[model samples]
Target: MPDIVFKSVPFSKEDVTLALESGVDGIITDAAHVDGVRTLALCDVWAEADMPSVALGSKAEEESIAARIASGERLVLAQGWEIIPVENLLAQPAVAGKLAVEAASLTEARLAAGILECGVPTIVVLPEALSSLKSIVAELKLSQGALSLGKATVTEVRTVGLGHRVCVDTLTLMERGQGMLIGNSSAFTFLVHAETEHNEYVAARPFRINAGGVHAYAVMPGDKTCYVGELRSGDEVLIVNADGRTSLATVGRIKTEVRPMLMISAEMETPDGVRSGAVFLQNAETIRLVRSDGTPVSVVALRPGDEIVCRADVAGRHFGMRVQENIREI
Candidate 1:
């Protein structure tokens, strides 16, 4: 692909058409033009022109970059991809600590290499010239041109495969929602609405599902996905089963009193007299189970033989439970 540098102009529908005819692969403009350009659906129009556009700001920041990406604008030119205006990517331990092999330099050539290593990605930049990184920048353009054909082929293959897999999984999940205890639960007992909801079976396996509250409990109706959570009021949730089939559920008010957790009671054979090994606790938000030494465990995974401890804590400023493994289990 040929590289065509653009400058800001009084763009109109006519201007965009002319740019395509003139063989412009990209457009470079100030942030001031962004709003007007977007109003024209610049991104979509450019795609019709068989081109991809980039957004250039005097300075690039995370939020702006994220916005541009969401707006279908590809390619961002800033001090560096890692160097956002408000935050230094290098200052972040996560980025700085990354293996040097992965760090892309500020120059064109290095940036191109970074893009190659990053898999033929798009880089957006402003029309202004950077004296410091010129040589590396040139290299990046060269590398991109050289690798375009091969990269497109690889991308096409991957896209087709991924799309096929997702379609199959979605269909399977939708079919399995018929009879399943798709729910979010605490340790004591599986939460259920006694009257409005009840247990059912699929292929003779017992399944207790409740469509309750402004919030309802459900699992995705597919085997490939495993997310069990409460659906908020007016929220839509998917119910999935072991075979990857799914169904959709719309939540209404709680029809009956809701229990908070799944209760499991078992007798412990101790060295002393047989003790009644039973524990009662509300779901995750109330009492978090933790190891004595303070390790987390999955609340849904507590078993009859498993040794566990409880913790008091909160996440996102809300109270919740933390599960820890017991010494015996360790």
Candidate 2:
């Protein structure tokens, strides 16, 4: 996500308050108002006197700014910054995180964010654009990017008696082919389809995913995973579509109870060989896994040799954070 800074020069208390409420990363204001801004909310405060402005229309000026940035000066580029200069500066390895741009409107902000496909990390929004700050921040932060999804062939599906299963209820209504990626191992995750399809027995639950056992790993943002048991209300989880496009969803509720569990085993074809993983989910008609064609197949109705959507990685995880290790779980 890009760092958003609100320019509070001409100092409007309302703008400062809006910035605070909008969750901006920092506030650029005069030193006298720093304390007042802090009294409203705690955030990074950049004194107006300390920020140096650089005219970045030419390559020579950009080089000068780059030199100052190398010396630990967080200089701000003047507004009306063209795309070529920003791209040139972004291409330099030394200017990775040392630059900020002043954006007068949302278009400039988006342009700064898309430069070189990895735009400037920080953007200072003028007070005039404070009214649109909330939308700007949401647009920058909610980008989920893409996910690497693979195919896994089902090998077994059998009942494992009664066990505790977790049902994740998210705030967003998922589409027909959208769900969470979960499994017994962090290296391999199955696309456990959402309960959005209606059945003769139960109504459609577009916001619920009968995830899996408490021990299973549910994919989280930042390429991390968390145990189903660790998820709680207000926590963010990754909602993946059948095409591997992902988005963020907030957990609204987590239901755990003793239910008959079904163990599913599947093998994924990797460059080395076929690797297998398993997930234990509730043995109920409502619980389903995604087929390769984006169809939902209930756990109770699943059979061997069925092709399902899954994701496999070689890196192991420790305490939900990915780590390099030669560990295996089955």
Candidate 3:
């Protein structure tokens, strides 16, 4: 993940507090208040004089910036930085994790983080950018990158006996096709639809996803997964849309209840072969899986050969993070 640092040259305690609260990784302050800022919080503090912002006006400056970063110098890019110069610098070799860009607004910060697909290693938010610090961090840091999703055909749907299922109640309201990715394995998962569709029997609870059995793996931010049973209030869960766009939301509450469950199995053609995956979900009228057209289908009505959206990958996860070592879930 790219880092966000706020520049507090004139030094406002309130601004520093806001930056820290907004989840910035570091703060660049002047020398006089180094001790004073340290007293406020245990965050990274750098003297403004030591690490100054570098302006990129010509081709030579790009080489100088790259050489400085390559030779073990940490640089914070000056405000008003352009796209071409950064793109040129990113094209050079060995430039990851050593460069930072000072952004005057959220727009620049977002653009800086997405340059050349990999983006800058760090972002420096100026004082003028403090107003939107929360938004900046939420997009650049909290919102994890893209998730690949595709359609899969359902092969089996069977009723499992009563079991504990998790209902993730997030603070964000979801749309029709927005929900969490959950399954027995992190590699092969289903997009369990959110409770956004209104029915005559029940009103929409757009913030909740009655995810799956307690033992299921729920995909999380940072390309990680967490067991549904272990989810708690305040933990972050990845919210995925049918289009594979992702957003971050805090789990306001976790509702675990004993409910009749259904075991759903699906398969999709992959480059390797026909890949299969399964998920255990509550067998209720409201619980749904997304269709390829971004529509929601109830689990009770889902039939064999019915195409629904799923995510498939190589089957190995070590403590939620993807790894190459061989492993299986059945």
**Winning candidate number (lDDT):** 3
The 0-to-1 C-alpha lDDT of every candidate, in the order given, reads: 0.29, 0.87, 0.90
Candidate with the larger lDDT of 2 and 3: 3
Clashing pairs in 2: none
- Candidates 1 and 3, the one with greater lDDT: 3
For candidate 2, lDDT tens digit of each residue in 1-330? 689999999788988888888879989898888878877877888788777557888878988988888888888998878888887777778887777999988888888888877788999999878778987786676658779888899999998899888999999888888999999988888999999999788999999999989989999998799999999999999999888988888999999999989999999998878888999999888889999898888888889999999998775888888888888676
Clashing residue pairs in candidate 3, if any?
Answer: none
lDDT at position 93, candidate 1: 41
TM-score of each: 0.22, 0.74, 0.75
Q: Write the residue-wise lDDT of candidate 3 on 1-330 in tens digits.
A: 688998998989999999999989889998998888887777888989767898988889888888988987878779878888888887877776677899989899889998998999889999998999999998988777678899899999999899999999999898988999999988799999999999999999999999999999988887788899999999999999999999888999999999999999999988888999899999999999999999999999999999999999777777888888878778
Number of clashes in every candidate structure? 51, 0, 0
TM-score: model 1 vs. ground truth: 0.22
**Candidate 1 wrongly placed segments (more than 4 Å):** 1-72, 75-231, 242-330
Q: Give candidate 3's TM-score.
A: 0.75
